[model samples]
Target: MFVGHGLGAFALVAFLATVAGCSRERAIQLGIVAGLFAFVPDVDIVYAPIGLLARSVQTVSPDVFWGTANTVHRGATHSIVIGAILAAAVAAWNIPARVSRIAAVGGFLSIIAIGAVVDGLVNAGVLVVYVATGLAIGEWARRKRSSTGWLFGAALIGLVSHPFGDLFTGGPADFLYPFDIVLVTSRIALHPDPTVHLLAVFLLELGTIWLAIVAYTRLQRISIRRLLRPRAVAGSGYAAAVFVIPTPTIHTAPLFVFSILALAIVGVGIPAHPFARHRRSETLVTGLAAVTVGAIAYAAAYGTLG
Candidate 1:
């Protein structure tokens, strides 16, 4: 559910941002901090979307919500400039003069209770961590300049890191919109070319998943080499199985073994771990990688919505 056409690869972006944020000292904590706000830019999805009834209604496409972003999903909101603006707002606003750990804990639980929104159910703990980090940072950035700078720094890291996730699927985000113009695009086409799109998505997910696996393995104190062997067996087996399933296709789906084998072979190179050596800061490097595989497989097997 947290996965999308790089649209909601917030986990991957959060993973990288956390690594650069606080080192291993606050890896898990800051990772959760960044993860919570990483997808806020997409909150613009509610512009014309049904409020609480969205899930029940199941409107196939959220037309206006995305259209507000200049007729695209990654419009004005996706801009690094907009991200900075948001960061400024957070910095300038008098959020809470002082927050106690007790208050933060209460707020964290409240946020989880309110997790009826998209992407909320899966990652509500992010909200909890975000507040916890904010409290910690607020104490550290006590000086006016330091406070503003740290606020700006963390927000910028969370906001700007996301559009690169969009690079895997849609047209590239316009990093510098009104001030200067630069539109990003992926060499791997998103849709029209279904096979190529799936291929690109598989690679993108593979990279992110590998990072998470390495980080998680280290965090759990599990040996990376031992971890990969089982995961490799599973992942490689899944890749191989993809071809054998009687999945639908435009052609004779039953006789599509060769095509499936080729697809699986492409995947065989995808490793259980992408790194030859996991870094010393392994705890900070990851979160939520395997979830995307299910979403990707469903889209590939089911084909386009139309």
Candidate 2:
């Protein structure tokens, strides 16, 4: 899922948290943490070299290490046990403060932990061990005297939304990772083939960018600068991530249509919702736009190279 989607959810949580026990600063902090930590499960991709090495080790000794590490969304890294450890450590290290420092730290930790575990579950569903571990930690976190419920809510939103977003692309999420049952999208037609793949990706990516613009425009009407900062940061990050990756080929007609719709949405819809605290619609639109553009550019480049 695009970080904007996650951030949009986090923004909702943060907004609600502000109405609850958390101060504005704390709520924003939680959103920041949630947005950043939501990317945790993806870290496995960064450690691909380790996964390759582990695959070799598994071939040598399958009984001991179990070859899960070689798979992107498997093992202890995505386990609840690791989540709990992270939550506990964060809570313990929290500096003493009157405003429930432990709660803040613990909340952020749990969100990160759970997000990682659930990411695997969304993909292959075989990640039961990880989910169980995460749930146990969640139970423990829930029992705390100083609980930041909003963080958990944000995490849940992040976990669930990711898989749903991937559905648009029809990519398999490995929802049943550690489990015997695995679920991939039954609807294969939506999945990007090399031919129209770039077109679809361009639509999604451009949509996200448009949504961010909408979000910013909406925030500007209310004159809340802080509310727009995360969107900017997320937008910049998305741009950076896309820039580093190769571009895909996109269909000109679809791209043109998507761009027009995006402009319309940003220009007309956002200004109408000046006081809206959450910009989910905008976020989703922008995310879709970005992915669409990205897929197209990537496909085109690959096609040319091949």
Candidate 3:
């Protein structure tokens, strides 16, 4: 879902921009801006390594490891309130008025102070990273000569749309944050069976990535389907893992993910003509196709066998 966050945002913004009469180049640029900011909320993941390092015993299951890593992942940074404040800060900072700039800085600092009081010094440090990210993006947008409103809209769309993606994978995000409200109380269940549910979520993620790829290829006037190589069929072999590995659920998918992704090697394996000019794109497209094929094969096998 990490990659999905940026790609999904990119697809949505880019497609809409195209429909709304923006030129291809300009639309791609706006999509890229939104995609970059979309990654900002996940900065809380920086705390994961710290959490892991502080542990007395490092040996842990996938569930425990990720549980520890995501301790602060869906908190303040995922909040729409925090996102709005950050977007406003970016907009205010872009204003030419001295008073507006001063207010932006002051408002940002005050938010940091509030975070410190509420979440403590360590989490306050995370807030600093978050605010710094928003400000840096603001500076980049300013350098690009984007209007404040456009930048604000990009930032808001990226930040606001992010937490919603989490509802399908993990605990619901603290969408309101700094407040105790719980808008979504549980992960959305796609199916009654755990395995089927995981497969549904996995397919959804793949669909999102495919959407981004389609949008990008369309913008660039490239044919994504034409880039594939026969090597992609190799990915279907991953279906065998259904019989060998333990059944994977959302909480225990490390093995399934690692094994399936390993099939990507088939794509980049020695080509008939290694030095072909289009080899890179061919291999990349094949790799993605392989993964897609592997997932579908696994899902099919799972359904048939059970």
**Each candidate: RMSD to true structure?**
11.5, 12.3, 2.2
Can you write out model 3's per-residue Cα lDDT over 182-230, one digit (the tens) per residue?
A: 8999999989898898888888888888888889888989898788788
List runs of model 1 lying over 4 Å from the truth.
1-25, 51-72, 92-151, 179-182, 185-194, 216-222, 225-306
Candidate 3, which ten residues in sequence have the lowest lDDT sum?
56-65
- Between candidates 2 and 3, the one scoring higher on TM-score is 3
Q: Can you give the lDDT of residue 20 in candidate 2?
A: 77
Worst 10 residues of 2 by lDDT: 228-237
Error of 2 at 106 (Å): 14
Q: Residue 231 of candidate 1: its Cα lDDT?
A: 25
Ranking by lDDT: 3, 1, 2
Error of 3 at 9 (Å): 0.4
TM-score of 1: 0.48
Please provide, for model 2 over 147-193, each residue's C-alpha lDDT reduced to its tens digit, 9 standing for 90 to 100.
Answer: 54444554444444444444444345555433435555443344455
Error of 3 at 143 (Å): 2.0
For each candidate, the alpha-carbon lDDT, in order, equals 0.45, 0.44, 0.84
Worst 10 residues of 1 by lDDT: 282-291
